[model samples]
Target: MWDAHMHCHFSGDSDASPESMIASAMDKNLAGICFTDHLDYDYPNEPDAFLLDFESYEKKILSLQQEYDGIFPVNMGIEVGLQPHIADQNRQAVEAHPFDFVIGSSHTCDRLDPYYPSFYEGRTEEAAYRRYFESILENIDTPVDFDVYGHLDYVVRYGPNKNQNYSYEKYADVIDEILIRLIRRDKGIEVNTAGFKYGLCAPNPCPQIIRRYRELGGEILTIGADAHQPEHVGYAFDQIPALLKDCGFNYYTVFTARVPVFYKLPD
Candidate 1:
């Protein structure tokens, strides 16, 4: 199995050390894994905004690489929150590192985190949902700087209203536009299974979106547990092969130097 998205202590929100996460993946007998640590730039009021030591983090990764070379394949990756207004800075920071994969994510919509209920304040449920989709639409055209876009429907995981009513059929036009942009830019999308841990019936960028992406000439896709802890490393991965088949995708993608390489999942 290949898990293309994950976090370690190098990221602000995670506390798992790289060694521990790697050990967990090895225990699960994964074929490969990527440590896509968070690289959020230009967020106001972020306590550790300038405290992430990339040099030290890279050195640690290098050390671990030598230690685990024969046990499992580990890729150095980073998840960058791409802001339209600050794209230049984010791109420069990403270039500064030697990453195997880079995941472009939109965690902020109109400068507000959807995780915060304040993002929904003063807006009707429909308006809030529409705005969220609009933000993703805007993010799609920003630039082509990463291998995959992380958790396209991440907002739904934290939205004030449950995502029961937010089906891809309801937003096909917008999603079509997003998929087209990704295809044109040669980028991929991720199937984040963390949503299932939140009691959500579907994963992030749910199966419907996955099907839509494939239908729209989008072929590259990656599966990630979005694990922040050891036990979550490869959660629900057993169900992904069948899901990809249902979505009309025969291959799942992995990356090196931010370039995608496809793998055939067993049926």
Candidate 2:
């Protein structure tokens, strides 16, 4: 299978080069991989911003694809940090590039970086988590030209403490709203296996939410490793196909030119 979401040096948070990521994915014998470098416009307090160099990035990927032709497909993708007000700006950026896929995410909830310890300060964890989910509801309020919403419950992954206690039942209303909307708009959620590497026993969304998505007729589910470095490419993927089948998904998705291609789950 493919590890659909990953980062490289173009994504400000990762140090790995794009070529290194490709080499590692090939070593793992992955069917393919995508480079979804970060693009978050107007990130609060970030000087350089997570905006990607679309021109140079596309050029580099194209050249690399040429070098590794017929090895394994290296798809060019982008991960946009969604800001509700700047939906148009985000649209323009994705449209300007020849990206095969786009992942809409919310790194800053309520104008604060949840990765920082300050995000959890002065508020109950419950309150913070709710706000983050609510932000996603607003971000996807309009149809973003993205294939899937990356890491549905990403906030829990980086809590000052690894969030081992959170449950989907508690946030059913908002989470359901997010799923219903995505299904309604022909979009989908990604099973980001990075959660396991980050110390959570489950994926970014946990299994409960994945089941809920299926129960509610949300069929478009994608699996990704969300690897930031070479060794982590496709990390935890071996465990995902089984989880997807148990969660009511008969198949998982990948994209090309922003269109999903579903592959059946192993028997």
Best by TM-score: 2
For model 2, the stretches where C-alpha displacement exceeds 4 angstroms are: none
lDDT score, residue 29, model 2?
Answer: 86
Please report, in order, the local distance difference test score of every candidate based on alpha carbons.
0.83, 0.88
Model 2 lDDT, residue 256, Cα = 83
- Which segments of candidate 1 are over 4 A away from where they belong? 47-51
Candidate 2: clashing pairs of residues: none
C-alpha lDDT of residue 74 in model 2? 87
Q: For each candidate, what TM-score against the reference?
A: 0.95, 0.96
Local lDDT at 265 for model 1: 93
Estimate, for each residue in 129-154, the C-alpha lDDT of model 1 and write its tens digit. 67877887777677537888899888
Which lDDT tens digits does candidate 2 get at residues 1-267? Answer: 888899998888898998899999989988899889999988989936797888889999888878888878988899998888778989888888899889998888878888888889999888889899999999988546888999999999878665756889889999999999999888899999989998898998899999999999988887788888999999988898888888988898889888889888765
